[model samples]
Target: MEHPARTLTARLLASRSLPRTDPQVRRALVDEAFRAELEARLAAVGLQLIDNPYAEHVAVALADDVHEPVFGAGREYAASNIGLTRDQIALLVIIWALIVLPKRERQVNRQKLIDDGQHDMFGQEAPLPHGEEVAGSLSEASLLADFAPVLGHKTYVQGKLLSRLAQLGFIERRGGLIFEGPLLDVLLDYRLLADRIIHGTLGEVLAQAGHPLPDSDGADEGL
Candidate 1:
């Protein structure tokens, strides 16, 4: 919501201001005020704020298709762990979609694996990643564990919800595991990559090459 307003504001900024006679300025002001009010309302609860405008400095490892944040690190963000606002929740969704989900996709598929199913680079020690059903508890998925800190939800709850999302057409799942394809698509469609971008140890190298930040969602940093 806030992003939409700001996007609208940016578009509005592109054109000249006509505050002297144009009534459109009022609408923009009203939108900003509404967002502020909404933020205030959310703050009335226990949710704190963190600026993710550019969601800079990748906090988690991700795939190549995911893009980095443009306004991160320097921008002001509003977030809350307890009483989240619609915008705050939306931002979380956007971050995972844009940043986390894409990176997850790149980590698991394609030519990286050998024809016999061994990893080309890792040669089978690629975490041998699998999900152990996650039926009785939420202890199976590490990605859920990784996300719990940022989203401020119980690991169990987050895993359960992700499982549920996977169950529906919203995403895909198998072997008690959830892949990044469908999930990343949803996040991208939702324009979510504006959250944290977890970089790998080779962050400098990737940044110089203008590539997506390296992350540890798959093997530990290296291929």
Candidate 2:
């Protein structure tokens, strides 16, 4: 049996190839049964198929329910925003742990460290002093540790994941530091989506890493 989506897709593509002056094609284009089937198939994936009388084109859009998840509940974030894979989500959670969370902790700990006179052999008490300088990057060793649960201890898989994320504008490596890139900021805008990708998709990996699931509010604050 031909799938409804496939049938609709074929009809739309066929219509595009023919001129509007063709009588049979014009009738098929305006057929109620064809229109209904196309709309029904699109609705199955949370989309709407609409005819534009003013133009010779059809506009397919997200259904009201899909928009509701984005503007109302905040649960369906990733589908609309930044695309993330399971491996990427694992890397993001690790980045959150190494960079975002620690930056906050470092600010609170700075005063205490200074008060306690914590200093290195060179007599420098302040560690980097700047949040981005200190916590915005990670070392390969640290990444390996954090990524082990998801990508495993395999160096090749780790390298591929890192390369893929970097290619996708998620991370950037300079010298020994791995900094969050511009795409991370976009991901942070949809915090609920990021949290869902992390906790919902990577629950076991997160548990193994001893990472706490993030609260919906302010989860993506520092990213």
Candidate 3:
């Protein structure tokens, strides 16, 4: 799973502004030391600390695996948007739908994937092969485009996200495919995979802020 770091959450915590009249509470992001401390505390609670930290947010996999909670508190996410934001979430949901809905996973939900004859974010056709060559300069290629065929998004709204998860370590390249490292190093984990399925850091942030995420659910066909 790929995750992008946001610049704003690094040094200071952004809070909702209020009219003057009271002492302002200093909201500070939990630094590395604090994160380690939280991990230790959670470990005591029988929860294994799966480190999934990002610049603006941090998340861990719960032992039972229902919901993975992100740490950053002040950030806001509106799961819904009129344009690309909604479409991106749809793509993300479709990816997850492939895994969670069991027999229906392969069945693309109509509402989730509205066939408007639009290419995915990468500007490529759908049901992409395990890999593909995007029509653009090498530098113009993004992680989203790389996965379009592998994930099979041919004629749907392209997700607005371009970030790929690589913070854990170095990167590897195999033709048009990008990887964290050698294939042997990969872990079979679905929790992290869901976050990777989600597109757009800002959109996910807004969605987490208790806004509408009407587009989070996507479709394919004959599901």
lDDT of 2 by residue, 14-120 (tens): 43222233453355456878656666766877766543221123434467778766556655554434455666666666675445544444444554455466744
Structural similarity to truth (TM-score) of each candidate: 0.26, 0.39, 0.22
lDDT of 1 by residue, 176-198 (tens): 55443222332232232322333
**lDDT of model 2 at position 84:** 57
Q: What is the C-alpha lDDT of each candidate?
A: 0.36, 0.53, 0.30
| TM-score winner | 2
User: Who wins the lDDT comparison?
Assistant: 2
Candidate 3 ranges with C-alpha deviation above 4 Å = 1-84, 97-159, 162-174, 178-223
Worst 10 residues of 2 by lDDT: 50-59
Candidate number with the higher TM-score (2 or 3): 2
Which residue pairs clash within candidate 2? Answer: none
Q: Show how many residue pairs clash in every candidate, following the order shown.
A: 24, 0, 22
Q: After superposition, how far is residue 165 of candidate 2 from its true place, in Å?
A: 1.2
TM-score of 1: 0.26
